[model samples]
Target: MKDRLSAFYWLHETQFAQISSNLITSQRRKAIDIFETEGFPTVRNEDWKYTSLKKLIAPNYVLPSPFASFDEEEQVEYKDIKKFLVNDIDCYQVVFINGRYSSWLSQTTHSKYDICTLGSAWKKYPKIVEENFNKLTKDDGPLVQLNTALAWEGLYVNVPKNIVVEKPIQVLYFTTGSTPVFNQTRSLVILAEGSSAEIIERHHSLTNHETWTNAVDEIQIGSNSSIHWVKLQHDSPQASLTQHSKINQEKDSKAIVHTISTGGKFIRNNLDFSLSGPGAEAHMFGLTLGNDRQLVDHHTRVDHIAPNCSSHETYKGIYDDYSKGVFNGKIYVHTDAQKTAAYQQNNNLILSEKASIDTKPQLEIYADDVKCSHGCTVGQLDEDALFYLRARGIRLKEAKALLMLAFANDAISDIQHPSLRVKLSQLIGRKLGVDMSTVL
Candidate 1:
């Protein structure tokens, strides 16, 4: 807490004005005040009891310069970062280097739709940023507040009404610097009525420098619209990440969010969905593969505010070595939300004796006519299945990997994009030390 406070004080004194302008000055100040009053969440906070930021916050991380220009000698080639992209897929790409937009490496469009950076939108279309910025974010968390106060560069996408984007949009953030640094980024996505789009967001570190990223995303789906949002976190082991996503759905709209976390030393994800109108639906899925001493925590909430709304959530984790995992999910059916249907499930597999997992699924229903259920399971590999596979030609490592793949396929099958599913499957196989190229 002291370290965080000291860093905040230093940033407030040195860099606050540089990051804020007349349009966002007041909002930044309010956010900074909130962070100062609330501080970092501790075990006393019910929502964060299973996860702690003591180690992540202990370092006195230097805030990266927002407008720092890279020299010609420091420029990164596309070939160096192309391996992290989905090479088989044709999509619009937006790349950010060290918290700044890389126009030379980005392919964006402003014709039928708006696909650009927050900085561009703020400068060119101030009204759009003014109308949507900070509207969906909750002011209850300190990390989010800090992001609100300091976020400068990220993706901004707006899909017009009745238009179906044939291609997905890929937004990638890469960090490259000699010194350990901290960064804050925000993304805003708005889908108009009857529109549909797919978006993929990822974070990667090119250097081994210790880094911390605080990211926030706000998504609003209009009536009869749909969105498929996926987040991939595969940074270096020295990196730490904290992300929050708030999604709002209108009448007859649909939202699907898939989070895959396979890297980073420490990661915490907060995902929330609000079904604000009748017939709205939300589907949430997550897969986390943690090894070594890494820690991955996911906290999710689905609020059914209107009648005839529904939500489905499933999360699976595989922990190896001395890694730890946490899953906390809640379903809230309001008093007026009759005929609400909500279901949640969390499962985990601990591969080593030292690996651990903590899971809690809660349901709060105020309407008597709602149907809500939640269940969780935690155990080791199925010995019977392992033996069955080993009895065949499969080796022990291959058998274990096959079992884990089968376990994660439950969520992987939900992916709507074929190339993305295959890419994720290959990454998962590599993480498990198995060759899945032929199987996938």
Candidate 2:
């Protein structure tokens, strides 16, 4: 902790003035102060009880510098990463390498909507960026504050009023370096009234080097607008990821988010939704497939602050080979949030004797006329179902794989993109060492 603080202090002393010149300087200073006081979270923290950052903290990871020029080497690396992208789908692309925007590999548009980098937006239109930046995420937390203080570049998207973005926007982050590196990134998305958009975010590692990413995203859904967001996490086993997303919805707006976590060394996701206007709705779904000592933890919260709001959350996990998974979901209905409807569910499948899971689903409702329900289940594959498949002359390994895939498909089926769904199915099949050509 001392070493990390020293590094941060050095960076602040040198770069804080330059980075905070155009933006709110006091805000950045305040965030850094909070991080300096709180430091990294440990097991003692209630929200972090199920996960620890000891290993991540021990690494001497330095902040990566922005690339001055794109060379042949980076071009080759970009080509190698193309295989990991959703190529079949046409979309506006925003690529980030080592936390810095890469224009050579990115495709952005401005005719119908503003799809660009936060740095570019901040430079070209400081007033517009100032109006929305940091407005939604005002809470104080260690990781979030750190990102606020150090985040250099990330994607920025805006959908104008009554405009429907036909193509999905793809934000891809790739890590490549010889030494251990730490990256802090921030993204913002704003949809005008009556507009709709679809977004896909993904992370990948091009090298085996140890990398840690702390990312924060803030999204604002306008009145009567809608958005569908998908996050795909498939980094190298040596990568550690911590992501925090805050979403705010307006009257009659709808927001749906889907998260698929398949690869990582240690991953912790914190997702929060705020229904600020009446008749707002939110739907969240997540799937985690872990193996070989991987640890994945998801913590989600939904706040119904207005009347006639609704929310639904469903998370599923499949653990094998001593892997561990954790799910904690909370729903809060305020005193004035009458007629609120909320539901939460979590289910897990433990495939090995050493695999384990910890799940908690809770609801705290203060409104008298509200409907809320929460439940969780942790168990193994049904023996009867496996036997039923085996009785039809299916091999044991194939049968087990089939059952596991079927169990996870419930969550995958919720994805709205056909090509993305097929890609994820194939990735899951490869991870399980099974051939899903026929089933998928």
Each model's lDDT: 0.86, 0.85
lDDT of 2 by residue, 1-440 (tens): 54465366555644655543455555667777788778888899989888988988787785764423443433434667788778889999999988878887889988899999887776676777678877766574788888877776888988999999999999998887776778888898999999999999998777688888999998999999999999998788998899999999999999989999999888999999999999999999899999998999999999999999999888889999989998999899999999999989889999899999999876788999999988889898899999999999987887888888888877878788887898888788888898877777
Question: What's the lDDT for residue 156 in model 2?
Answer: 91
> Cα RMSD (Å) per model?
2.1, 1.9
User: Which pairs clash in model 2?
Assistant: none
- List runs of model 2 lying over 4 Å from the truth: 1-6, 9-16, 19-23, 67-76
lDDT of 1 by residue, 227-292 (tens): 998889877899988999999999999998999999999999999998998999999989999999
Distance from true location, Cα of 21 in model 1, Å:
6.2
Error of 2 at 302 (Å): 0.4
TM-score of 1: 0.95
